[model samples]
Target: MKKSVALMVGLRYTGAKKSNHFISFIALVSMIGIALGTIVLITVMSVMNGFQSELQERILGMVPHVVVGERGEGVHDWPEVEKQIVQHKDVIAAAPFIDTQAMFKARGNTRYGLVQGVLPEKEKKVSIISDYFIAGSLDNLKPKEFGIILGIGVARSLGVSMGDKVTLLIADGGTVSPAGFAPRQKRFTVVGIFEVRSEADSMITMIHMQDAAAFTRKGQLVSALRVTTNNVLDAQWTAYELRNQLDDKFYVSDWNYTHGTLFKAIKMEKTMMGVLLTLIVAVAAFNIITTLVMVVNDKQSDIAILRTLGASPATIMKIFIVQGSLNGFIGTILGVIGGVALAINLPQVVAFVEQLFGVNVIPGDVYFIGFLPSELHWDDVILITSVALSLTVLATLYPAWKASRTNPAEALRYE
Candidate 1:
């Protein structure tokens, strides 16, 4: 019966028309603020999650998850090394590669890039490079043909296209003659172009492994063995285990060696952004304190009357707690509904806005992706709602306590 009375009184106070219009307006503002904060938090988190996912797919997909190489010039028995690498359960495939830095020149233009020598058949098993071809085919890189594949950015900078010739000047493999050192140079036909829409597009080129061995004079030796793992996140651990099993002369590396900093930076940025956005919800929750304080002041006589009529201090506190909690509950629900709807269709909404404004929000050249992506996780919504509600409940405590302390004589005296 006590609980029922508190619930009845709380519902009446919350729904009753207020004499002070300003208090009602302030309460409305608090509710709206909470809703707006939640919406922004959820949407931003979803976009950040999407960006992480896309980067993992586009960038990590193009690079080796794990690489096993010799500490010296090159791995002499790469075929045996590949066999040993694939025996690990986590490893899906392994391929031989020769990596070197070179300057590519064509049409009087030169661009510095990392050149990778790969077997077309084995490379396809370890890397997603085959999926990103803009023109030509990987099979065109026939052994002894000296065919090359250029990143789209490299081709554009060199002003070359398929069937055009490009010269690669390798400084490391230069021959020292009686007069001076001469750089090793080779001419290759541009047989393919690929675009991953990342720095790789401007920095990486590919050719046949046989040709690379001949040019580098490493003859039958490979610089490294590229490895694919069943799980990209576990590649580092897998690499460590494989290294322990390999010869002491071999060194092992994983994607983290090259891109871990980028991922860690992204994660830190997401955490900081989440903390800042959460403050908005916290501010909105604090507004509940102001709203409840005004309500307690306005209803002093009512509180005193209830005290006189045998209501306990705890009952009065319960009434105010219920009222304030309702505001938070309603706002949280509305915000979740609005945020989820917006997040799920963010791509379409972004496209529409871009079209309407005649502006490109995400430029393909500037960003790895050309579109805004959103991936809403239900856990994020639940977490935001819980935090908002907790703040709201805490904000009600002081005002409710004050109302509970109302003296019947003093409050009725004013009435």
Candidate 2:
């Protein structure tokens, strides 16, 4: 019954009209601060998650998960190696490729990039390049015809489009001429263009595998067998296992070797941003301490009367704890609701803002994507709420203890 009375008194005091309107205002401010902090933290974390996903899809999609190659000139028996790789349970698909670095020239403009030769039919199973074609289909890359596909950035730099002729100058197996060694130059018709809105768009080009073999004078040899896995995150383990299974002369590599540093940096940035934003919630929690301290000072006479009526120190402490906890709970609830709604619609909101202001918030040429993205996870919301509530509860303890220690005679001496 004493506990019930404590609860009732706490509830009444929280909603009761106070003599000091400034106290009420301070409490309101504290609640608003918590809510604002939560909303910003949740929204920012969701957008960061979105950026991570975009990197995985746009960048990793073009880069193979795993690659198998021989230590010599190239993979001499690529078909047999591809067959063996497909037998692995974790391997989704394998495609032969010939990779080289070359300079592309068109309309008096020259650009340097990686030139990849692929079998169009098999390439589709191991890569997403087919999905991003802005011009002709991958089927246009027929053997011996020397048809080439240019990344959008390379296409723009060369000032060429479909059906235009481009010159490829390669140093591999270059012929010795009167001017020392000369690079092999060949003309190829532009058959397709693809854009992934990533660095790959500026640095990658594709042609028929047979054409690449002829250009490099490797006959039937391929540079490597690109492999796709069921799960991209497990590609390193899969590559390791494949290495153990293959001959010592063969080497296996995964995307982690090339792009791991980039992803790690992004993850670190996300963690730092999360920690920094959490400080905002902590600052708001400090306001709870200030509000509770003032409340203890204002309720000295009431506390004395309660003590005279036989209320124990424990009950007095519980009363203030209840009041402060209620404030935190209400703020947390409001923050979660507002934060979730905003995160789920963040892209649309950004688009609306850009439209209203006539400005491009995310430029395709600058960022991996041309629009804002958001991916809200319930776990982040739960964590932020837990941290906010814990801080608020801790803030209540000192002021509640001070209120409990008020002497009846001293507190009511001038009442």
Candidate 3:
């Protein structure tokens, strides 16, 4: 019965039509603040998660999880190395590649880029580059014919298309002539073009392994054996394990060596954003402290009456705790509903706003991804709600204790 009385009185104190309109208004403001803070935190975190996920998918899909080769030397026994690498449980596919830097000259424009020689069918096993073909076909890049596949941006920059010939100049391989060492030059037909829509699109070109070996004078040896894993996130660790499995003289490298810093930076930014937003929730929850203090001051007479009627101090504490907790609960629930709905459809929201404003927020030429992405997590919502409620519950303790210590005689002296 005492518990029921405490709950009823506590609920009454939180009613909308309370005697003190100003105190009621303050309580409402506290709830709004909490809801706003939680909404922003959840939405922002979801967007960050989406960006990280998209980047991993796009970048890792194109780059191999691990690349194995002899340190500063081409892999002469790549077939044996590939056989060993694929034996690992995590390795999905392995392919040999020859990489070299060269300049492609076409239509009077010259652009320097990395030229990779790959066996089309074998390369398909380890890379998604073939999946992004915008023009021409990978099979057209035949061995002896010296056909080449250029990136979309590269093709656009060179103003060349299928059947057009481009001159490839390799400074490392040359024929000794009377006019000194002239760079090895070869004409290749542009057979295909692919678009990843990133910096790679402007800088990567592909040709058959036979032609690449001939151009670079590397014979049958490959620069590296690229390995793809089932899980992209495990690339770095898997590369380390592969190094140990192979001979000590062999070198192993992963995407981490080239792009790990960007990945780490994204994660750090997400964490810092989460922490900063949590402070906003904390600030909102702290408002409950001020609200409860004012409520206690307004209801001094009521507290004293309850005490005189034999109500225990613990009951008084429970009363205010319930009241403050109710406020926090409402705010947390509201925030979760709003935050989840917003986060789930954030991309659509962005598109709509962009269309309405006649502006482009994410341009394909400038950004890796052309649009905003969002992925709401239930775990984040639960954590934010729990933290806000805890702060609100704790905020009630001091004011509740002060209310419990009220003197009935002193409170009623004026009456």
**Compared with the true structure, what per-residue lDDT tens digits does model 1 show for residues 1-415?**
9999999999999899999999998889889988998899999999988888878888898889999999988899988898999999999999999999999999999999999999999999998889999999799999999999999989999999999999999987798999998999999999999987776788889999999989888888899899999999999999999999998999999999999998898899989989999999889988888999999999999999899999999999999998888887788788888889999999999999999999989876677766688989899889988888898888889999999998989999957
All-Cα superposition RMSD per candidate:
2.5, 2.2, 2.9
Candidate 2, 23-72: lDDT as tens digits: 99888888988888889999999999988998899888999999999998
Q: In candidate 1, which residue pairs get closer than 3 Å at backbone N, Cα or C atoms, i.e. clash?
A: none
Q: Each candidate: what lDDT?
A: 0.91, 0.91, 0.88
Ranking by lDDT: 2, 1, 3
Better of 2 and 3 by TM-score: 2
Cα shift from native, residue 212, model 1 (Å): 2.2
Give lDDT tens digits, candidate 3, residues 1-415: 8899889989988874788888888899999998999899999999998888877876777777899998766888888988999999999999999999998899999998999999998888887788889888788878899999998878988999989999999987777898888888999999999987556777789999999998898998899998999888888889989989999889999999988898899899999999999999888888888999998888889898999999998899889988988998899889888999999989899999999999989875577666787877788878888888898888789988988888889988886
- Model 3 ranges with Cα > 4 A deviation: 104-112, 152-170, 174-190, 195-199, 363-370
Q: Score every model by TM-score.
A: 0.91, 0.92, 0.88
Clashes of each: 0, 0, 0
Candidate 1 has a TM-score of 0.91
- What does the lDDT read for residue 148 in candidate 2? 98
How well does candidate 1 score on lDDT at residue 244? 97
